[model samples]
Target: MASRRTTRRLAADAGLLVVAAAFVLPLAWVILSALDPHANLRVKTPDGLTLDNFDAILTPEITFTPLLNSLILCGGATLLTVVCAALAAYPLSRFRSRFNRPFLLTILFATSLPITAIMVPVYALFVQVDLIDTMQGTIFFFAASQLPFAIWLMKNFMDGVPKELEEAAWTDGASAFQSLLRIVLPLMGPGVSVVTVFSFVMMWGNFFVPFMLLLTPDQMPASVSINDFFGNRGMVAYGQLAAFSIVYSTPVILLYVLIARRLGGGFALGGAVKG
Candidate 1:
């Protein structure tokens, strides 16, 4: 029995190492290739490190404008999604109704539907409305695409807060909105962070949505503009591509760092709920 257990443990550890390597190797290639001026598809050490790759792609046309567009699009969408999700979730969390379960189930169903399945109709609608190349239009769609899952997550987190606290606030003449803003939301900081980060990251990395909606080159976000690295006939600038990728990833990293504390902090509701 002891021998069998040892063998199983060893096998599990080996499998995990293999899985880790699969992810780590690609990331390693990206980092190393970014430093190599003449990078290729193969992962190997360069003759010497150089910053030429970074220098080449740091121009306003290649990096600055698209990055600014991404920040505007993803940032606006994330803020909108979080606010809408909070408002939509509050009633579902605090009220009792037979419709809530069905509504939530519908939201869950919506989340499972792939973006590609509806893109055809969405594109046609955008064209009809003359919003095909607009930034605000893209932000609206981005928020809508992420809203379903955001509501689901927000509702689950909001449920964790005790109703007694809201009742006390009600007795003090606070409105539903006030109670939500001052009490429930403060207690559910981790959930908001999760939703904000999830929404922003999803929008930031999304290539297809913005690609289909925005036609103007000047309006394209970093997600769509990164395709410029690939040239005709399967040619690609691997070094510059890797450098752009690292720069493109900076905002999301910074967002996570900013919210790290709130995301890790669980609801401190024990004392408030005890009495």
Candidate 2:
């Protein structure tokens, strides 16, 4: 039995390694393509590997304007989503209402709804308001779209927390908001981090909304800008496209790694302080 269990564990580990490789292969290809010297506007790969693609993206040949726009939009969307989630979660978690069950269910239902169903009305409204080519408008759209899931995730996490902490804080002369800021927010680190990561990734990766709403090419997100690497022109751009994609995805990869590393450390620290 012991030997069988060990064999099963080894098999599981091998299976996971295969899955990880499958997920990583595309990224590896992108990195390799970016380094290929033949990557360019024409139909032929450059003779050897070079950093020219990175140079073109970072320095002159290709402008960083789209990257800058993406950063601003993503930042705004994250702030909006987090704040809205925090506020909504507080009420939903604490309040007992005859309507609470239905309300929570509705939020879950809304989250499952696809964005495509609402795009037509959303687009028409944006047109009426003259917000067709702006970062603020894009941020607003992203925030609204992300709100339901953020609220649900936060509320579910908060619901598991005990009410006694808040009562004690109140008895000690702390206001409701103060108790929330001091007692509740500290315990909500994991959930908040998860929601923030999801919101940032979604807003950063979104291409359809940016493409439809941003009339000016200057306001395009990096996700949309990547389309320029390919056109009626040819195949040589594939190498450059690969390189650009690798660069674009690097920040997201780093963000995920940083979050994962901090998650356990954060919980440990919080536990120590509480003890």
Leading candidate by lDDT: 1
**Candidate 2 residues 1-275, lDDT tens each?**
99999999999999999999888766566766778776544334347878887776674224477778888999899999999899888978998888788988888888889997777787899999988788899899999899988888888778878999899988999987887788887888877887788779878888888878787877778888778766533654767677778777878877767666776543533342222
- Each candidate: what lDDT? 0.88, 0.78
Superposed model 2: Cα runs more than 4 Å off:
1-24, 39-49, 60-63, 232-236, 263-275
Residue-wise C-alpha lDDT for candidate 1, range 1-275, written one tens digit per residue? 99999999999999999999887988888899999978998789975899999999999999999999999999999999999999999999999999999999999889878987888899999999988899999999999999998898888889999999999999999999999999999998877887788789889999999999999889899998998778431678899899999999987777766656554433322222121
Candidate 1, TM-score vs. the true structure? 0.88
Question: TM-score of model 2 relative to the true fold?
Answer: 0.84
lDDT for position 72 in model 2:
91
In Å, residue 216's CA in model 1 sits off its true spot by: 0.6
In model 2, pairs of residues that clash are 38-45, 38-46
Best by TM-score: 1
